[model samples]
Target chain A: MSNTPNRNRQLRSKLGRVRGLGSSHEGVHHWWAQRMSAMALLPLSLWFIFSLISLTGSDYVAFQSWVSEFGNSVFLVLFLVSMFHHAQLGLQVVIEDYVHSELWKMGLLLIVKYGSVLFAASGIFAVLKISLAG
Target chain B: MAEDDRPLSPHLQVYRPQITSVLSITHRATGVFLSLAAVMLTYWLASAAYGPDSFARAQAALESWFGRLILFGFTFSLFFHMCNGIRHLGWDLGWGFDLVKLRMTGVLVIISAFGLTVLSWVMAYSHVGKL
Candidate 1:
């Protein structure tokens, strides 16, 4: 009895068991993160847009001074991080849906993931540089 | 590639385009566009951080007619995505699932998206006294 495979466990084909090509069990996490980041982005994005509108007609110095404010720097960093995270998740779904070729899907996913992180980091670094160095 | 000959799942081409379907695809399309537009945002920030000369160059490029067009599109896409995203969130909570509600909200999303985009641009141009 102890050695017997459970009926449910025995239902899977041997190849299916070996391949493990089923739900990753992480889909819920992905879904939750996408929604959470999107929620964060709503307010952050609205604020950022209004701020940009306010900064219109302002010169480089004006923009720099705006970013140099402590609150502005913090919000900018938060916005960048959330925006990239949300964008990457959304793009991943898009590529996975449209790109049937396995190679293309994986390649595009990697590009979006890495590209998002790189851009987020660059934006954050720029914000910090302007805020702290000046 | 499969040897099977069976009816396939209905895809985009199979169904006649409707407002619901159009808005659904547009949500995704705008999302993809916004992802690419993020590069410009990063460029703007980095250039500003570097120095005034670089920032000026970035500004000039962004102020060009072509750049304004792209920016206008970006603005519209952002608002559309944001508005539709809220509708999605409502659906996630099991609200607004009825056909009537769905159509109403869908139209609302489109109207609000365009209204906000135009309003934002108006505010921007007015701020610069360019309108």
Candidate 2:
């Protein structure tokens, strides 16, 4: 209705006035993801530390048997991928702030994002294969 | 774009050295190093998944002198970065901003990094029966 149109206009104008303000939606979510992933890693990393200590003298079969467990491998894969995502985002911020050249900054960020995702996926695929084969 | 007319910001090259400055730079450098290590970890995982032969090859490399050195450095870097990152997080939460507290935390981070690295390796080595 005509009244709805007026309300929409009012809202648009209000938002427009705030449009050029300092912050963007990007930074908040990125910061949160970094923090969340770091928090997640706290427990997982502790688990991994203990597991690695246990695996220290483990023969090949023993290590494989451990990783072959569905829950452990899945969680380990999750940890690795999330860690990569968080690390990539953190590194992107570092690069953008430190690298003076705009072109290089953009290029490096793209490389980091794609490279991290690729490596994470490949690692996960490898884990899946190893676990399934066992 | 004007060569001489544009305002320029100061940089590290203009500043004298200090321990804090050095540590700050090393923190970033080690972060970059950790990124590289993550890539290697992915490779190691992929190889382990491939087969026993692949895992053996990866293990052999890790057992070599060069690999051991890299692993040692990475362990130290990991501990240092973890400690320093916690220090930063504490500051972010508004807890250690005073100069004295900042300096004390910085020293504490270094010592803790060393202590943690030693403890981890001792545990790892003992488990492997190589201690």
Interface RMSD of each: 1.8, 2.1
lDDT of 1 at B86: 99
lDDT tens readout by residue for model 2, B46-122: 87887778888888897799987887788788778777877777876899888888888889988998898788889
Per-residue lDDT tens digits for candidate 1, residues B1-131, read 66344433347887899989999999999999998778889989999999999999999998999988999999999999999999999999999999999999999999999999999999999999989
User: Ignoring the other chain, what TM-score does chain B have in each prediction?
Assistant: 0.91, 0.89
Pull out the clashing pairs in model 1: none
> How would the docking of model 1 be graded?
medium
* Model 2 per-residue lDDT tens digits across residues A20-89: 3224434356766877776776667667766777787666688688889988898879878876886797
Poorest stretch of ten by lDDT in candidate 1 chain A:
A20-29
Score residue B10 of candidate 1 by CA lDDT. Answer: 43
- Could you give the fnat of all candidates in order? 0.77, 0.55
* Candidate 2 chain A weakest lDDT stretch, 10 residues: A19-28
lDDT of 2 at A111: 95
